[model samples]
Each structure stands twice: as C-alpha cells, then as structure tokens.
Target chain A: EPEVTQTPSHQVTQMGQEVILRCVPISNHLYFYWYRQILGQKVEFLVSFYNNEISEKSEIFDDQFSVERPDGSNFTLKIRSTKLEDSAMYFCASNAETQYFGPGTRLLVL
Target chain B: EDKVVQSPLSLVVHEGDTVTLNCSYEVTNFRSLLWYKQEKKAPTFLFMLTSSGIEKKSGRLSSILDKKELSSILNITATQTGDSAIYLCAVAGGGSQGNLIFGKGTKLSVKP
Candidate 1:
C-alpha cells in the first residue's frame, strides 16, 4: 500500500529560528492537510490545501505558519519564528476521501 | 466551528476482554466519521462510516455510527496486548475540501 512519507523525522531548532517540515503525500491524493499535537494533547488542525491554495485554516495557523506544495509530491510547512510552544509532532495528511497520514515530524524548539 | 469529544480518556483491560470506546461530535454538514489506531507513529485507518446504525467490522474490531445522536463507538473483542494504543476518532464535513476535525482520542491498554 502507498503511504504518505515525511522527512526529517526529528528536528531541533533554536527559538526565533525557522524550520520547514516536509511530506510526500500518497500519489493521486488531491486534498492535503497539516495538524499538530502538543505532548499528550489533542491533534489540532492547522490548515487544509487544495488546488494549490488554502481552503481553510484554524486560528492556530497564523502569519508565522505557511504551507507549500513546491512540487507534485512534496508538501511543506514552514514556521517563520519558532517558539518553545511550537515544539510538537506535526503531521501531514492527504486524501481523496479516506485520508492517510505520514509518520510525522517531531519539532523541538529550545 | 466543529468539536469532537471522546469519553473514557484512558482504559485498562486484560487480554480476552471486550472494550468499547465512545466518540461524539458537533459539527455543521457532517459527512462521515472515521476511526484510527495510533501506536507510536502515523495513525492507521480503521473504519469510515457515512451512514447511521450500520456496523463496519474488521477482524476483532468493529464500529458503528449513530448520526441522530452524532456519536460512534469502536469495539474491540478478544483484545490482545497488540490492541493497546490510542484510538482516535475524526469527523469530516460535507464539502469538496475534505478537512477533518479530530478528538483528543481514547487510550487503551490491553494487558496480559
């Protein structure tokens, strides 16, 4: 079975620095999404993308956060200024109807 | 805004026991309810229910949805240590966009 894959399984960055998390969604999946989970917390939706444009975003997705599908397969989430609170497991998902998730990128900002 | 709530935040059961996890949601344009099993990494899809009162089953796992009450239940029978994990419930709303609203999840520990 084809599965979504993410790069940089784990990352450590300094506060105020920038970080980019990458994902390769399953082939033929049309819709893409980004969600995050603080340690022992619920998964929170950040944003959804379709047709190379953002469809909807939660308040948590602010100016500091951006998503791009730079190519056909890669979807990336960029944080302009990382904060201690930004440390979490960021997951990328894709779906035609049934969604599939990537292993996730663990972001740690100190 | 949409919200999902799961009950019995954490459960401990012995092998061969039966367990039921509950999920409820309040959202506009509810399209479908889905269940996933998460161990350490990516969550694995378990079931998707678009209609009410219909049961979907896979091996020892089964799920049913109640659209009228906006709730769903995932049941695991003859549970084993391998069944221990966090189970997540998510709801998708009507629209072409296909975004998911997820609950905090129910953690299950099946001990032998």
Candidate 2:
C-alpha cells in the first residue's frame, strides 16, 4: 500500500532558529494536512493545504508557521523562530477519501 | 468548537479477552468518524464510520457509529499483546479543509 512519507525522522533545533519539516504525500492525493502532538497530549490540527493554498489553520498555526507544496509530491512546513513549546511530533497526512498518516517527524526545540 | 472525547483513558485486558473503546463527539456538519491505532509512531488507520448504525469490521476489530447519540465504539475481540496501543478517535466535518479533530485517545494494554 502506498503511504505518506516524511523526511528527517527526528530533528533538534535551537530556540529562535528555523526548521523545515518535509513530507511526500501519496502521489494521487489531493488534500494534505499537518497535525502535531505534544508529548502526552492529543493530536492537534495545524493546517490543511489544497490547490497550493492553505484551506484551514488553527491558532497554533500562527505567523511563524507556513506550508508549501513546492513540488508535485513535496509538502513542507516551515516554522520561524521556533519556541520551546514548539517541540512535538509533527505528522503529515494525505487523502482522497480517508486520510493516511506518515510516520511523523519529531521536532525538538531547545 | 469541534471536539472529540474518548472514554476510559486506559484499559488492561488479558489475552483472548474482548475490549470495547468508546468515542463521542460534538462538531458542526459532522462528516465521518475514524479510528486509528498508535504504537510509538504514526497512527495507522483502522476504520471509518460515515453512516449511523452500520458496522465496519476487519479481522478481530470492528467499529460502529451511532449518529443519534453522536458517538462511536470500537471493539477488539480475542485481544493479544500486539493489540496494546493507543486508539485514537477523530472526526471529520464537512468543509473544504480535510483536517480531523482528534480525541485524547484510549490506551489499551493486553498482557499474556
């Protein structure tokens, strides 16, 4: 079965630095989404992307966060000035009908 | 605001036991409810319930949705140690955006 794939399984970044988490969604998927789960917390929605634009975003997805579908398969989330609270497991998902999730990228902001 | 809540945050069962996980939600324009299993990594899709009173099953796992009650239930029969994982419930609402609102999840531990 085809699955969503993300790069940099784990990342460690200094506070105030920028980090880019990358994902390659399933080739035929039309909708893409980003969600984060703080340690011991529920998964929280961040943003959804479709047609090269943001369709929806949560409060956590503030000015510091941006998503781009720079290529056909590559979807990337960029966070500027990362904060300690930004550390979490970030998941990327794609769907035509039911959403499928990637293994996730663990971001550690120190 | 859209919200999903799961009950019995944690459960413990012995091998060959049966377990039921519950989920309830309050959301606008509810579209579908989904169940996922998380084992130290990403969540793997288990089932999706779009209509009420209809059950979806796979192997020893089955799930049913009750739109009238705004809830869903996931049942695992003859559970094994491999079944120990966090079960997450998520709801998708009708909109252009396809993001899912998730519940805190129910952790299940099956011992030998």
Candidate 3:
C-alpha cells in the first residue's frame, strides 16, 4: 500500500537554528496536514493545506512556522528559529476523504 | 474549548479476553468520530462513525457512536497479544478542512 514518507527519521538541531521537515504525502490526495506530539502529550495540529494554500491553522502555528508544497509530491515545514519547546515528533498526513499519516520526524533541539 | 477525553489511560488483558475502550468529546459542529490503532509508528485508521446507533465492525474489533451522550466505545473481542497498542479517538468537525481533534488515547496490553 502507498504510504506517506518523511525524511530524516530523527533530527538534532541547535536552538535558534533553522530546520526543515520534509514529507511526501500519498499521491492523489488533495489535503495535507502537519501535527506535533510533545513528549508525553497529545498530538496537536499545526496547520492544514489545500489547493496550494493554507486552509486552517492552530495558535501554535505562528510567524516562525510555515508550510509549502514547493512542487508535486513534496510538503515541507520550516521553522525560522527553533526553541526547546519545538522539539517533538512531527507527523505529516494526507487526506483523500480518509486521512493517513507518516512515520514522523522526531526533532530534537539542543 | 473543544476537547476529547479517553478513560482508563491504560489496561492489560489476556488472550481471548474482551475489552472496551471509551472516548468522549465536545466540539463545535461535530461531524464524525473515528478510531485508530497506534503501535510504535503513526496511527492506522480503524473505524469512522457519522451517525448514532450504527455499529461499525472489522473482524474482532467494533465501535459505536452515541451522539446523544457525546461518546463512543471500541470493543475488541477475543483479543490477542498482538492487539496491544494505543487506541485513539478523533473527531472531524464539519467543514472543508476536516482537521481532526484527537484524544490522548488508551493504551492496551494483551498478554498471553
């Protein structure tokens, strides 16, 4: 079965540096989403993208965060300046009516 | 604030045992409730419920929605140790986004 794929299964970065998490959602899906799971916490939605633009976002998705589908098959999330709290497992998902998730990129900020 | 709550954070059962996991939610413009199973990786979809009273079944697992009580329950009968995992309940709000709000989940451990 086709599944969403994410790059850099585990990423370690310095505080205040920039990092980009990459995902390739299932082809033919129209909607994409980004979510994070803080250690020992529930997963929280960051943003949702549809039709080449952001359709919805949560409070946690602020100026420092941005998502873009630079081209077909690639969805990326960038953080301008990382913070310790930004450390979490970031999951990228796609929906063609039913949603499917990627294995996730575990981001660790030092 | 909209929230999803699951009960009995964790449980342990033996093979062939029957178990029920609970989920309750409060969200604006509720559309559908869904269940997923998570092991070590991302969650895998299980069932989606849109209306109350209709039961969705897949093999040994089944789920039902009770909109009147704003809750749902997942039942796993004749459970196997492989059934051990975290069960997540999420709600899809009515709109184009279909952005889901998920509960923390119930962790189940099935022993031999």
Candidate 4:
C-alpha cells in the first residue's frame, strides 16, 4: 500500500537554528496534516493543509511554525527558531477518508 | 476544547487473552473515531468507526463506536506478544480540516 514518507528520520539542531521537516504525502490524497508527540505524551495536532493553504492550526503552531506545499508532492514544516521544548516526534499524515501516517521524523532541538 | 479520554492507561496480559480498550470523547460535530497502534516510531492505523453500534474488524482486532455515549472501544482477541504497543484513540471533529484530537493512549503488554 502507498504510504506517506518523510525525510531525515531523525534531526538534531541547535536551539536557535531553523529546521525544515519534509513529507511526501500519498500522491492522490487531498488533505495533509502535521502532528507531534512529546516523549510519553499524547499526539498533538499542529496544522492541516488543503487546497494549497493552511486550513487550521493549534496554539502550539505559533509564530515560529509555517507549513507549505512547495511542490505538488512535498509538504514541509519550517520552524524559524527551535527550542528545547520543540524536541518531539513529528508525524505527517494524509487522507481521503482514513488518514495514513508516515514513519515520523524525530526532532531534537538542543 | 475537544477532549478524548482513554481508560486503564496500561494493561498486561498473556498470550491468547482478550482485551478491551476504552475511549470516550467530548467534542462537537463529531465526525469519526480512529484507533492506532504505536510501537516505536509512528502510529499505524488500525480502525475507524463512524457510526454507532456498527463494528469494524480486521483479523483479531475489532472496534465499535457509540455515538450516543460519545465513546468507543477496541477489542483484541487472542492477543499475542506482537500486540504489545501503545494504542491510541483519536477523534476528528468541529471543522472541515479534520484534524485529530488524541487521547493519552493505552499501553498494552502481552507476554508469552
């Protein structure tokens, strides 16, 4: 089965540096989403994208966060300034009816 | 805020045991409830329940939604050691975007 794929399975960055997490959602799906899981915490929604724009975002997705579909296949999340609290497992997902998730990118901001 | 609560945060069982995981939610414009299995990295999709009373099943796992009670349950029969994982329950609602609100998850450990 076709699944969502994400690049840089694990990323480590300095606290003030910028990092972009990339995802290639299932080719035919129209809705794309980003979610994060703090170690041992529940998965939290970050943002959702559709029709080439952000549909919704959570408080955690503040000024430092931005998402873009730079190309037809790539959905990317950019964090302008990483923080220690920003360390988490970020998952990209896509859906028509049921959402399918990628293997996830573990971001470690130190 | 939309909320999802899962009961009995951890469960331990032996092979061939049957386990039932519970999830309850409070959200407006509820669309669907989903179950996922998380081993180490990502959460793998298990089942999606949309209507009340109707059950969705795959192999030894089955799930049912109770819209009236705003709850759902996932049942695993004849569980195996491979079934040891964190089971997450998420609900989608309130907008067109369909972003999910997740519960803390129930961790299941099946021993040999």
Candidate 5:
C-alpha cells in the first residue's frame, strides 16, 4: 500500500535558475527512475538509478541534469540551469519487478 | 528505433459500453509490457504482461501480451463514467539503461 511521494507538487521558476525535484521512493524498491511528460507528449525517460549509481539515462538527461540518492530514502534530480523547454510534469517511479509512480511535480520554467 | 505506439488516440463511449485499447511495440529484446491509467497526475499501475497468450485480469480490466504480433490489448467491459482517463502502454527490455519506452497514450471518455 506504500506509494512513492514527491515534494512541492508544483513549482514555478525563472529560466536559468537552479531547481531540485525531490522524491521518496517506496522504502523497499530497488530501482528508481525519473520521467517527464510535456503537456501533450508521451512520457519520456530521464534517468534510472540503482546501487547508488546511474544505471541508464536518456538523451534528454544532458550535462545540466544530475541525480543523487543523498540518503537512504530520498532521490533527487537537480537541474543546474533551467530552460523554458524544461517545463513539464516530472514523475518519480520505483521498480520492484513492476513499477509504481509518484503523484508528480509540475515544473514551470518561465 | 525502439518505440511504443497506441491506436485510437481518443475515444468516447456510453457508460455501459465496452472498450478495447490497442498497443503495439518494436522494442529491442522486449522484456515486459505495462498498462497504466492516468487520470490527472499519477499513473496508476494496472497490469504487466511478460509472456504471450496468458491473460492478466483485475475486476473489469484485463490485458494480454502477444509477443509474436509485437502488440498488446487492454479490455474494459461495462465501462462507467469513472473509467474516463488516458491509458498508457510502456515497454521495458534489454539494451542499456533499463528504462521504459512509452507511447502517446489513448484518451478515453465514458459518458453517463
């Protein structure tokens, strides 16, 4: 019954500024991932994390993006400098054979 | 390129109607196909299909994977207004990065 949780359900930031989206994946899940959905586009993978290292990443996950476990429970995605195109709903998912998603953080870069 | 594609980008049906959503994929070393219901924010997990022929069901929802055809289908019978939402199909498999590839999704609207 446990669900992945994210902080700041919504965020509005100025372009070129730094932002960090936080996620607390299900306690026992092994693999963690970050995905984004543009208003009318398909959900796209950003990055995947396991064993405290990045296992895989998409082209969208450029040098500006970085992910860290930080601790036992928190997985964070930091954007070094935001861009208008970066506005989207970011979801944090945890996989345990099957994947479960968080409610998502709506990021708006203006 | 490895990708997932869904059909009938949008659908509208009466409350008592039945609807079948289709998803086809061409993912490399396909491992599993997953169905999710996205209402507003979070995508609620519905089912995961790995093998072909065998069906996985839950209540009014059922899904099956056809590896040979490189596709899958989700069936919702006796639908209700609450069934309205976007259905997403995603595939995961071999290659690097163990990430899921998603389709644009099918938008369903069940009217009461």
Candidate 6:
C-alpha cells in the first residue's frame, strides 16, 4: 500500500537555527497536515493545508512555523527559529477519507 | 478549545485477554473520530468512526462510536504480545480541514 514518507528521519539543530521537515504524502490524497508530539505528550496539531494554502492552524503554530506544498508531492514544515521546546517528533499526514501518517521526522533542537 | 480525553493511561494484559480503551471528546462541528496504534515513530491508522452505534472491525480490533455521549471505545480481543502499543484517539472537528485534537493515549502492554 502507498504510504506517507518523510525525509531526514532524525535531525539535530542548534537553538535559534532553522530547519525544514519534509514529507511526501500518499499519491492522490488531497488534504495534508502537520502535527508534533513532545516527548511523553499528546500529539498536537500544528497546521492543515489544502490547495497549497493553510486551512487552519493551532495557537502552537505561530510566526516561526510555516508549511508549503512546494510541488505536487512535497509538503514541508519550516521552523524559522528553533527552540528547545521545538524538539519533538513531527508527523505529516494526508487523507482522502481517513488520514494516514508518515514515519515522522524526529527534531532535536539543542 | 476542541479536546480529547482518553481513560486508563496505561494497561497491562496477559496474552489472550480482551481490552477496551475509552475516548471522549468535546468539539464544535464534530466530524469523525479516529483511532491509531502507535508503536514508536508514528501513529498507524486503525479505524475511523463517523456514525454512532455502528461498529468498525479489523481482525481482532473493533471500535464503536457514541455521538450522543461524545465518546468512543476501541476493543482488542484475543490479544497477543504484538498487540502491545499506545493507542491514540483523535477527534476531527471545528473546521473543514479535519485537523485532529488528540488524547494523551492509552498504553497497552500485552505480555506473553
């Protein structure tokens, strides 16, 4: 079965530096989403995208965060300035009726 | 804010035991409830419940939703060590994006 895939399975970055997490959702899936989970915490929604535009976002998704579907397949989340609290597992998902998730990119901001 | 709550944060069960995981939610424009099994890196989709009373099943796992109560339950029958994982419940609502609000999750450890 086709599945969502993410790049840079693991990343380590200095605080205040920039990092971009990338994902390629399942083919034919229309809606895309980004969510993060701090260690031992619930998965929190960051933003949702459709038609190459943000549909909705959470308070956690602030100016530092941005998402883009730069191409037909690539969906990316960019953190302009990383913080210690930015360390988490970032997941990208897509859906037709039910959402499917990628393997996830584990971000570690030092 | 839209929120989800799961019960029995953690559970331990022997092989062949049956387990029920609970999830409740409060949100505007409730769309659907989904269950996922998280082993490590990412959550794998399990079931999506939209209508109440109807049950969705796959192998030994089954789930049902209660719209009136705004809750859902995931039941695993004839469990095995492979059934061990954190089960996450998420609600999609409030907007058309279907953005999810997740519960803390229920960790199940099925021992041999």
Q: Which ten residues in a row have the lowest lDDT in candidate 1 chain A?
A: A37-46
Task: Please write out the lDDT profile of model 1 over residues A14-48, one tens digit for every residue.
Answer: 99999999999998998999989999998888999
Off by over 4 Å in 3: B94-96
A21 Cα displacement, candidate 2 (Å): 0.2
What is the C-alpha DockQ of each candidate? 0.73, 0.86, 0.77, 0.91, 0.81, 0.93
Q: Which window of 10 residues has the lowest lDDT sum in candidate 1 chain B?
A: B93-102
List ranges where model 6 is wrong by over 4 Å: none
Question: How would you encode candidate 2's per-residue C-alpha lDDT over A53-99 as one tens digit per residue?
Answer: 99999889999999999978899999989999999999999998999
User: Which candidate, 2 or 3, would have the higher lDDT against the true structure?
Assistant: 2
Output the worst ten-in-a-row residue range by lDDT, candidate 2 chain A: A50-59
True contacts kept of each: 0.81, 0.89, 0.78, 0.94, 0.89, 0.97
How does candidate 4 fare on TM-score? 0.99
| Candidate 3: residue pairs that collide | none
Candidate closer to the true structure by lDDT (higher is better), 5 or 6: 6
Q: Which stretches of candidate 5 lie over 4 Å from their true place?
A: none
TM-score per candidate: 0.97, 0.99, 0.97, 0.99, 0.98, 0.98
lDDT of candidate 5 over A53-100, digit per residue (tens) = 999888999999999999999999999999999999999999988889
Better of 1 and 5 by DockQ: 5
How do the residues A1-110 of candidate 6 rate in per-residue lDDT, one tens digit apiece? 89999999999999999999999999899999999999999999999999889999999999999999888989999999999999999999999999999999999999
Chain B, per-candidate TM-score: 0.96, 0.97, 0.97, 0.98, 0.96, 0.98
lDDT of 2 by residue, B1-112 (tens): 7899998899999999999999999989898999999999899999999999999999999999999999999999999999999999999984557579999999999999
- Per-candidate TM-score, chain A: 0.98, 0.99, 0.99, 0.99, 0.99, 0.99
Which model is ahead, 1 or 2, in terms of DockQ? 2
lDDT of each: 0.93, 0.95, 0.93, 0.95, 0.95, 0.95
